[model samples]
Target: MKRSTSNQEVKKLNRNRVFRYVNSREETSMPEISAALSISGPTVLKIVNELKEEKLIREVGEFESTGGRKAKAIAAVRDVKYAIGLDITKNHVGIVYTDLSGKALKHERVRKPFKYTQTYLHEVAAIVRRFVEESRIPKKRILGMGISVPAIIDVQRDYITNSHALGIYDVPCEELTACMPYPCELLNDANAAAITESNRSRTCSNLVYLFLSNTVGGAIIFGNETGIVRTAQEKDRGSVYMYKGNNWRSGEFGHMVIHPEGKRCYCGKIGCLDAYCSALRLADQTDGDLERFFREMEAGNQDLKKIWNEYLKDLAIAVDNLRMCFDCEIVLGGYVGSSMEPYIQEFRNLVAEKDIFENSGDYVYVCQYQQEASALGAAIFQIEKFIDTI
Candidate 1:
C-alpha cells in the first residue's frame, strides 16, 4: 500500500504539471496538450479533470479528431482573473483594465499639470478605483494590480527612488496604494514596457527595448523573459543592474550624455539621450509645433529630412551599442516607436550600416503594440506572479 501511494503521488504531480502548461496559453485540446508536454493521454485526462473540478480550467469548444471522437477544447478561465496596469508618467497617468490573457477591456488617462504634489498619487489611485469599478469584473477575479512608474523604483523599499521631474524621492508605493482593494506591484516604466514587449515577441530570447516618451529608459531581456516578483519590504534591490553589464543599468540610459553641451535633462544634465530621443525633444525641435514638423516630414521637406536622418542615426548608434553589449534583438518603442511605421526601415538601414556583428540583419525589430505595451505587459507580469504563487 505504501508503494501504491508513492505511485499515486507521482501521478498527481505529473497531472498538475500538464494542467499548468496547458493553462499558460490559449485554448487547446487534450491531445495537443499531451503532444506539447509529451505526456500520455490517461495522465493528461486525469490531471485536466482534477483541474476542472478545482475551477481552474474549463471546456471551451470542440476540435476535429483524426479517426476518433471529437476532442474537447480547454482553456484557462482567464476572465476570472483580472489585472490592472498603470503607467504613472511625469505629465499624466495612463490606466488599463485587462483580464489574465492581457486583453485591454478599458483604458483611461489623466493629465499632469506642471505644478502638483503627492496628492497626484491619490488622484491617480482614484482614477484606478473608478476604472476598476466601471469594469464590473468581480473583485475575486482580479489577481492584483501592477503599476508602471516613470522613475527609478526601489522595489524592496516599495518607493520611488528618484523622479526629479515629479520631485519625488523614496516615496513608498504601498502607502500610496493602501486604499487599493487588491495587492499592488511597482515596476520601472521602461522595464515594464520591455516586459510587455517581450511577452508579445516570443520569437526572440534576448532583446533590448527602449521607452522614449516624456522620459527615456530601457529594459533588457537576457533569455526572452521577465521575472517580475513580489517579496517583502526588501525587494527594492530587485533590479537587473546586478545581473547585466555595467552600462545596462535601467533608467541610466536616458543620462548617457549624448550631447555634453545640449539642452539640460530633467535630471539636471545636458545633452543626454533623453534630451535627444524624447517626444519632448522632437516637439522642442519644432518650437512646440509638433504638427508642423510631422507635416513637413510627411511632405518630404529637405531640412526636416536632414534632422530626421540625424535623429535616426543617433537612435541607431544607441541600438548598435546595446546590441554589441547584449548580443540580442533591439526594439524601438515609446511615443517615437508608435509613429515608427514609416521610419522603422530607415532606422534599420542606418544600424546595418555600422553594426559590428555579422547577424545584424536579424537583430532589430519594432514593438508590436505601441500605445498600451507597458499596460498589457504589467497585466501579463501580474498573472505570471499569480500563477507561480498558486
Candidate 2:
C-alpha cells in the first residue's frame, strides 16, 4: 500500500520551498515567488505573512510596477537565527558565528593544542559563551553549535574514531558537548569545508573539494537543486583512485606512493604524497614558515624554488588523477589552497603539463575561503537542520 502525504506535510513542504526560494534571491515579490514556484498567489501571501510574523523574512522595499500596483519585495531575515561553528584542530581552535544565511558575523582563533580533557572542553565552552554574549545574540535565537575536527567521526555515537594528527583516539563526544549550553554536533573538518563551499556555489551540482591543511582531506558532492550533499564515506574522505575490490587505506591521498623509497612519511610510508605536497613540506623548506618560503622563492631563492617546483609536480599528479576519476570541478581548499590563488595560473600550467587531456585548467578552482571555512561550514550545518525541521 502506498503511504499518502498529509495536508500538513504538503503545507510544510510548500512553506520550505517558498522559504528556500526567497532565501536564494536578493528580494522577491509574492507574485514572483508564486510564479517561480508554481504556487498560488493566495498561498504565497499566507506563507509570506507567516514568515514575516515569525521574523524569518521582512519586506525590504517594493519592486517596479509592471503597470499599476508596485509589488512589495521581501527578503530572508539574514540574522533571524544564529549558529556557532568551532574548528578544533591539533594546534588551534577556530570559532565563527554565522547567521541564518550562513554568513560569518564574527570569527576568532586561539592557538591552543587540542586535548581530550574536561579542562580543555570547559575552556572551549567558556570561549563560546563569551563569544555569544559579546555578539548580543539571544540564546534562544541560536539554533545550535557544530564542531569540526580533522578526524573520522562517528556521528551516531558522537565519538572521535581516530585522529592521527592530534594523536587522539576514541574520545567521547560528551567531553565537549557536555560543556556546551546549546545543542551540538561533531563533523569532519574536510566535510565541513565542503559544505561551506557548496553553500557558496549553489549553482554547481558536482564538486570535489580537497582540503590540504596539516592533513589532506576531501569531500565529493553530487546532486542537483532539489538537494546536494556530500556522500563520501568516512574512510574515503580523501583517498584517490581506489580500484574495485581493493582494500586501500583512507587518507592515502597524503600517503599515495608518489616516490619510490624517497622521503619517509609520518605514516611510516616511503614516498608518500604528504612528504612532497603538504604545507608542512613547504614549511620544512623555509624553517616552518610557508610565507617565508614563498617570499624567498619569489626573491629568486634557487633552493626554495627547486623544492616548490618539485612539490607542484607531485601535486599535479594527484590532481590529474582526481580529475580523471571525478571529472568535475576540483576545489583546492584549506590554508595552503587559499594562499595558492596568486599562483593559480602557474599551478594550472603544471596540471596541464601532466594531464593527458587538454583544458585541465577549466576543472580546477581555488576555494573562496581560507582559514575559517571549516568553522563556517560547521555552523551552516545547524542552519541546515533548522531549515529541514521548518
> How does each model score on lDDT?
0.70, 0.79
Clashing residue pairs, backbone N/CA/C < 3 A, model 2: none
Cα shift from native, residue 383, model 1 (Å) = 1.5
RMSD in angstroms, candidate 1?
A: 6.0
The estimated TM-scores of all candidates read 0.84, 0.88
Candidate 2 residue lDDT tens string, 1-390: 997768997788788888877887788899998898778999999999999999888999998888999999999987778899999988789999988677788899998988878898889899899988888888888889999988777666667877788788788877668888788998788888888888877664577777877777777776342233433221222212212112212333676677877899877889877777778878877777888988888999998888888877888888888888777788898777878888789899888877677755767889987769999999998997787665
Off by over 4 Å in 2: 1-8, 225-252
Clashing pairs in 1: 154-236, 155-235, 155-236, 156-234, 156-235, 156-236, 205-224
Q: Tell me, what's the RMSD of every candidate?
A: 6.0, 5.1
**Could you say which candidate leads in TM-score?**
2
Residue 192 Cα positional deviation in candidate 2, in Å, after optimal superposition: 0.9
Q: What lDDT tens digits, residue by residue, belong to model 1 across residues 120-181?
A: 66666677778888878787887888877676776655667776656676777765567655
